[model samples]
Target: MTLYPRPDVALICGVDEVGRGPLIGAVVTAAVILDPTQPIAGLTDSKKLSEKRRVELAEQIKQQALCWALGRAEPHEIDQLNILHATMLAMRRAVAALRIRPEWVLVDGNRTTDFGIPASAVVKGDLLVPEISAASILAKVARDSEMQALHLAHPQFGFDSHKGYPTAAHLAAIAEHGVLVQHRRSFKPVRQVLEQGGL
Candidate 1:
């Protein structure tokens, strides 16, 4: 078994983003300041966890964290600013919302615009850092919950089934039912719908 490394900083906050590739909904980011005094087990990348496990870990992180916060950039913002900048904005907002300021931030990616505090971008950091993993779990579960709620508004697209990813089912629904307001019109499928006069 390989051991994930924890940040060496005294008060480190983990940052991560979700929904960057979704064809709909907001890009959500989460920042978690873990209590080094009380470390949680089973912390790893959110992608490595089952949905049930992610939900469980999200709850555990919330309950056991020193401070945590979530932020998001809406579809319109993503379209206006581009996904990369929008994602970074979401991360910045998440860190800003934290009740306790972190001395250092460990972000799970190759790039970050700014973190307010000293920060380092860890390539595939989510899999290697407990705090980053906690952030990933929070971001994934929150975005999933949002997509599930959107499912209630547009059951025809089966948002619950695909969680806003561009699945064959979702594409078929768009082709058949036309694009809904929740769908990102700037995305490839939605753009195709418009170009093909499906809208």
Candidate 2:
């Protein structure tokens, strides 16, 4: 790991999003400015960690990070703006909601909006950057919790297990129950179901 001298740099928040590929629910993002004095061990991309580990790290991040905030684009927003634009909207909101304004924004993916702040896009940032990793964990855990809640409301969709991804089980559920209000109408699978006259 290389040394990052914070003295010369402006406050920076690492940003990342989850649920872009999901068939239902909102796209969630998080921006985190980690406290340099309170370094967290074992931070990595949320997808690389176990669910239990991600949950543990998420709590630690919330407690120890200098500032953190979550933002989201609801299903209707995704349908209206398309996934890519909706994701950028969520990222912008995450930055705006931060307690401390970041002089620089480091986003996980290779593309992002200006957000009226200086921003740089990093490929695979969630894996290479600690701040991005923390953001990834927070975003993932929050979205997963939302999926669990949706599961409670519609256990037939198996949201708790598949998290609204287009798994065989999930597709079958859509075939049986039809698309729910939360389903992304612009997504191919859901659109196909709707085209077929639905359930």
Candidate 3:
């Protein structure tokens, strides 16, 4: 709680990722440098908030934060580099794209990536840190919007509802309709379907 404006550091960025478990689309990440002067209320892990609230907060964060940037690792990159490494790559890209350079970074989760700056990994940071919470909201909102777009393109997959997760309906869709380029080929369900010549 209250992990910003350290006695020594001024600009601190929060980092978080979304969509690591999804079967389709990219792993998206967000880096946020909150404007401590403009404190945001109702900040928490994105999963804890309603989609409507997350969308509202995402817009507020984008407008109020000192700087923020989004990054993503595509499905092809996820297959080539694996989810863990691809997530780290996405985190790095999010930070690198920031308009304002952060003096220190606080990333949610147990692991931290090399952002060429001082950084620490705060477990459950999205709950404890406002910055990370903002990042989580932004990342989730962005990725969910993508899933909605994918739904428009491939309505049979029900992407709008499942957001490309390995739900029973999604697996059934893959089984019946075959995998789209958006599906991560390395994922077990997709791989199983492909190996069985389901495609």
Backbone clash tally for model 3?
0
Q: Kindly state the number of residue pairs that clash in model 1.
A: 0
Summarize candidate 3's per-residue lDDT along 2-38 as a digit string, tens digits. Answer: 6643426899999999999999999999999999899
Per-residue lDDT of candidate 1, residues 1-199 (tens digit)? 2534654668888899999887889999999999978889999989889999989888989999999999999888988888899999999999999999999888888887677588888888888888888999999999999989989988888999898889899889889989777667778888899799986
Least accurate 10 contiguous residues by lDDT in model 2: 1-10
Candidate 2 lDDT score at position 199: 48
Top model number, lDDT: 3
Best by TM-score: 3
- Give Cα-based local distance difference scores for all models: 0.88, 0.92, 0.94
* Clash numbers, per candidate: 0, 0, 0
Off by over 4 Å in 2: 1-8
Q: Write the per-residue lDDT of candidate 2 for residues 1-199, one digit (tens) a residue.
A: 3323333465878999999999999999999999989999999989999999999999999999999999999999999999999999999999999989888888998887988888778888888878899999999999999999999999988899999999999999999999999999999999999999994
Pairs with steric clashes in candidate 1? none
- 1 against 3, candidate with superior lDDT: 3
Error of 3 at 104 (Å): 0.7
Predictions ranked by TM-score, top down? 3, 2, 1
Superposing every Cα of model 1 onto the true structure, what RMSD results? 1.6
